[model samples]
Target chain A: MNLAFRDIRHNLGRFVLTCFGLSLLLGVVLSMIGIYRGLVEDALTLARSPQADIWVVESDSRGPFAESSRIPGDTREAIARLYGVSAAGAITYQSVETKYGAKKLRLYVVGYELDRLGGPDKIVAGRSIVRSHYEMVADRRSDLSLGDRVPLGRNMFTVVGLTENRVASSGDPVVYLSLRDSQELQFELAPPAARREMARDEGVPGINTVNTVIARVSPNVEPDLVAKAARQWKHLAAMTQMEQEIILTRSVVERARKQIGLFTAILLTVSTVIIALIIYTMTMDKLREIATLKLIGAPDHTIIGLIIQQALAMGTIGFAFGALFISSVKDYFPRRVILQPDDGLALAVAVLLVCILASALGVRLALKVDPGEALKG
Target chain B: MSLNGSHTLVEARGISKYFGEGDARVDALREVSLKVYPGQVVGLLGPSGSGKTTLLNVFGCIVEPNTGWMSLDGEVVYDEGWLRSDLRRLRLEKIGFIFQFHNLLPFLNCVDNVAIVLSLAGFSTTQAKQRSVELLEYLEVEHRKDAFPAQLSGGEAQRVAIARALANRPRIILADEPTAALDSARAGIVMDLLRKVAIDQNAAILAVTHDEKIYDRFDRIFHLRDGYLDIEQERGVTEMTQD
Candidate 1:
């Protein structure tokens, strides 16, 4: 064992170079897994923040991304009156492309009742929205800071606060505004179309409606009862917090989840094959030495152990490099690459296993080598 | 003659080894028998294709013969079947081998390479290392202990190989053309070291070589031809016939 370690130390340059190559591949695998985890985390962050017990939307729809769900603006008022409903608020959601400097940025605009119940839980910078309209709390990733003005539709809103990681299902950074703003952004028609519709409808202004009503239930009251009462109403669907998150994840981001899963699987397969080939080649290169060891009474187990130890060393070094490399450069990527501790740990274990399995090919070759070959001409 | 009650370190009876089968079969050794007693140097001399290596392999317990009764260190080790399943342990504990080419692991320093056999035999790392250093000092290569095998000269490497072979303190040392790669001077030095190790350690040494120039140094010489062995007494020694 001492000899084996000393041998590796003597050839440290080649060993480290091989480890670096392995680490790059391992880093890609780790990044893929992290990206998938990031997507899931980003989807749930907004939903979890509201602290709402139940969500009310249109019948037979998954919100707030997969399908349209518009409820009467007065639905919150009605739900507030219901038994066991402690608080209810109208919320609207929409994705829009807007200009920031010379670049176009995609934003998930979340409309909430500023004072009622829905808003960013904590502001990291500046102050929370003080005005009712044309003010927003932007997630830090949106590149918006306090006092910065961003154009939305025909109006421009000043960013009042900066939050972190508040992204929508599609992983776009979120911007929070009063419910009226989000509703207008989603439902407000063009001025010409609005005039044409009003002219056709005898010039009466339309009432406001919203995509969904989120409610908090009292601890003493059963949540299912409130949800049942809301579902009894026409054009309404009520779900508990758990159900809403599931609906969004299973319906809105189902395709992305599957795509990420497929990518992870393919990357893992490629990594395994590449590691196996590298170990096999290394073993083949040392065939003569291995034969001599065998001839000199070195046991098969010793030979196998040498190969396995080398494989494990390669994997450990590669994983360390990959982890460091990805985290150091993750911020520069367009999409969020979340490198978490658990993800790193899992990848380390996986890479180690891959290396062990990979070196089996080398072990087989070493085992089949005839000791007699050492004596041959 | 039976070596049942003698000081023989290795004894073989009617050893036969064949390769392949049917018409393609080649008999590498046929009905070969030899005895090597402790504290003596025995040389097996033969030309190419004369079964010298085949006999060495059988004596080294690396290849099982088709028919043989072999004993090592006064204990039966083979009788048409291997008596020990752990050939590696047998090789490490009972016999030492020095090859023509100094097959030291390239990545290891001279001392570590010498200590490898002891380490494989379950010695502590520190103990094996210390023993290797002691042996190198004995062989007069201690100054080059930290040098890798590649950095050592031919004579130093060969001397290191002898030290490695003696690491386990085996009762028998087998040298298969150990000096084949060296010049006359280096070969003489290696042979002298082998003889000193045999006498100082009280171990039997069996060396097979084509070099006849060093024959007088061996205590006994066996001439092998077509897998048959003939004992040749030295000119000054009296030949003892079977009673």
Candidate 2:
């Protein structure tokens, strides 16, 4: 055993080179897994941080993404009158392509009541929005620093604060604005269209409404009861936080999840096949030496150990490189690539298992070698 | 021809080995029996395609004979059947083999290559290394202990192989054409070292060779023709000519 390690160390260059190649493969696999996890995390961060218990949206619609839900803005006031409702806030959501410098950025613009219920949970670099309109708190991923003016619609808004990883279900970075500003963005028509439509409606513009009303129940109250009570209203359907998340996952992002899952499976299979081939090649290179060792009375287990140790070493080296490579370049990716310690640890263990399994080819070859071959001239 | 004081270290009784079966069957060794004793250096002389190597393989416990009983140190190791499944371990502990080419692992230095067998036999690394250094010094290659096999000359490499074979202090040393690759002078030097190690360590040695010059130096010579052993006794131990 000691001799085996020493032999590898003595040939450090070859071993390290082999390990480096394995590492690159491992790194790509790790990055893919991280990206998949990051997508799910980024989708739910905005929803989770607010700590709302229930969401009221249009019936038969996936909230904020799959379809539009416009309810009377006064729904918050009505929901707050319910027995278990402690607080309620109306929110508006829309995705828009806006310009920042030379780039056209796609942002999920969220309109919320700043004083009562909605905003970034924490500001990473700047202050939260203080005004009712034209002030924005951008997710850091949007690359907007404080005081940077972004053109949205026909108006320009100054970025007041920067938050981290707050993205919508589509992985678009979020920009938070006052409820009134977002409502106008969501429902306001062009001036010419609005004027013509109002002329037909006797000079009265359409009533103001919101996509959904998010509600928080009292600490002692059951969120399910509050959601059921809100659902009694015919024009609205209320969903608890859990139900809303499920709907978002199953309805809005299900396709993306499946795609990421398929990618993960393909990468795993590729990794396994590559490792197996590498081990098999290395074993073949040492076939004569293995037979010689057997003839000289080195046990079969020794030969097996040598091959297994080499495989494990390759896996360890590959994983280290992969983790470092992915983490160093994660930010450059279009979507968030979250590299967590637990994820890396799991990948390391998984790759190790793959290596062990991959080395079966080598082990079988070594075991089948004929000691008599060593005596042949 | 029987040297009484040098009790038998290896005994092969009516050993026969065949390959394939039916029409394709080939008899590699046919009813060959030989004995090598302690304090003796026996050489097996044969041409190519002869059964010298086949007989050596049987004696080394590397190949099972079709029919025979074989003993090492008066213990039956084969009796028309295998007595042990761990043949590799048996070879490691009881038999030492030296080939024509010095088959040292290239990745390891001379000391490490020599020490590997001891290490495999469960000796501590320090003990194995210490024993290896001692053997290298005995073989006069201690100065090149740190050099890899590739860094050594052909003669130095062969010496290192000899040192490695003696590392485990086995009961038998089997040298398969150990000097076939060397010149006359280098071959004489290697043969002298083999004889010295066998006498000093009190271990039996069987060397297979086609070289005719060193035949008189061996204590006994066994010639294999077609598949049978023909024993010849040399007059006495004589110092090898240094040239």
Candidate 3:
């Protein structure tokens, strides 16, 4: 019989309890990893979803996600006429909070020309936005069903379609609107603010500002070359789609990544310490048995195997428990928890290594036990 | 003891052991010497500080004697220091130990407790199990083979302990106080079992004990006092002279 398993079998209740406790800890670690991945994925979604080859924004700006970058809405026309430009559209982005039913909801609003490159990549339900004004495509996370009319910026817009996994870097669900409506919503001041501005004789600029002018390059043309051409305009900062994604990750969500990574490291350290203490305690509990084992001439490897095997079993079972628990309830979390296969595999490997390292304490204690102790009492 | 010297299973000569140093030093064993032959159940009788257990540890390959000549199954295993690199393997092959408390692994059932020894000796699981069952059956505890250590009575646990000791068919069995925890009747039964095991397996049995109730069961008894062997008590019991 495998002695380690026999010992576990002998004390199954305690073993299971220990594993359950460990699983919850591991679950938190896994969730942090998932949340971190989700944060980056969310930050990159809008940049990637538009499927543009190049981005033309305000001069010297990393926007539209990392910072504010408002160019004239007419920049789309200039970008479209540029050499090698296949398609171009000006899009505006803003975060809005509004009352829906009795609940307050936050949303990320994106405005794009109907025939342009920027739009929700997929409509999982209902139809795409058909009207230039008063029609919207909302992410399912917003709980806006088809035909739901949500008031926004002095106008009511009907939800004509629904999307999934489309959210802002801050995790607010994204909603799509026609460029005309979005400009009105994003740049339009409240009636009182507008009146005050008019009374002060400061003429209200027309609501014609867009966060970014996204362009698709011709298949045979290099997007970088097109971006370089746009940058020569000096008043406009342009970047290829890859560069935009880099900015989003590095500027928009970098701190969150570092924070999550630090928390994960801390949790893993705590887990290692907890596992070490637990193994040490378990070894201490069985010191006599270990002594007897030694007295009976069991090999050092056998003793080491017993401790390491127990640690590994605990870690494996705990990881499975944590993974399953997190997977079953991830949707309930406000932030997306994306548990990818690769992440799980990596975590499993990490847990395996951690278990081995943690078991060192127990193995050391066990190896140090004097066989003569068994002959004592 | 001068048994047939050719059949001596375990022999220790001038085995001197000390603990600590200087003012705090203790002579746990002083020039102790003895020999046990196959099929003999030998008992070392002594008081609490008489060093019986220490001597047993030395013979069991647990403690390295500061100075000694030791042999098991006619092979020199320790001379002043361990002659073998792996004392554990040497012990596993030729020396079996039975603790006073029947230190069978609490987690393993009686059969596994016994079979683990054979397994450590490199027997296949099936072979180990088969041998363990035969040993348990021989000791009349086959019915309790699946019972864990806690479930066994003192006598039953000791019987299982004996079975484990015989698992690898070691040439020598060193039991420390095999019957100290047993009642007189139960102690007699355990002693009978040990004697039976010794004769049946042709293994030498050296046991340390303070219990005199089962004293008659041993084929030869040696008394120890103040780390010195009572050669007077051993003289009438064996033909070999203590050096």
Instruction: Choose the strongest candidate by lDDT.
Output: 3
lDDT by residue for model 2 over B46-121, one digit each (tens)? 7776788888898888778999888886678899998977778888988888987877777789998888899889
A287-321, model 2: which lDDT tens digit per residue?
77787788778887788888999888888878888
Candidate 2 chain A: minimum summed lDDT over ten consecutive residues — where?
A1-10
Model 3 docking category? high
Residue-by-residue lDDT tens digits, candidate 3, A1-377: 67889899989999999999999999999999999999999999889998999989999898888889989878889989999999898999999998888988899999988977899889999988888889999999998999998989789999999999999999999999999999999888888888999999997769989999999988899998999989988789999999999988988899999999999999999999999999999999999999988888899999999999999999999999999999999999998999999999999999999999999989999999998888766
Instruction: Give each prediction's DockQ, rounded to 2 decimals.
Output: 0.47, 0.54, 0.82
TM-score of 2: 0.94
2 or 3, greater by DockQ: 3
**Per-candidate count of clashing residue pairs (backbone under 3 Å):** 1, 2, 0
Please tell me which model should have the higher TM-score, number 1 or number 3.
3
Give residue A268's error in model 1 in angstroms.
Answer: 2.9
**Candidate 1 residue lDDT tens string, B99-168:** 8787788888888888888888889989999999999999999999999988999899999999999999
Chain B vs. true chain B: TM-score for each candidate?
0.93, 0.93, 0.94
Reference-based lDDT, residue B183, model 2 = 91
Clashing pairs in model 3, backbone N/Cα/C closer than 3 A: none
On a 0 to 100 scale, what is the lDDT of residue A265 in model 3?
Answer: 98
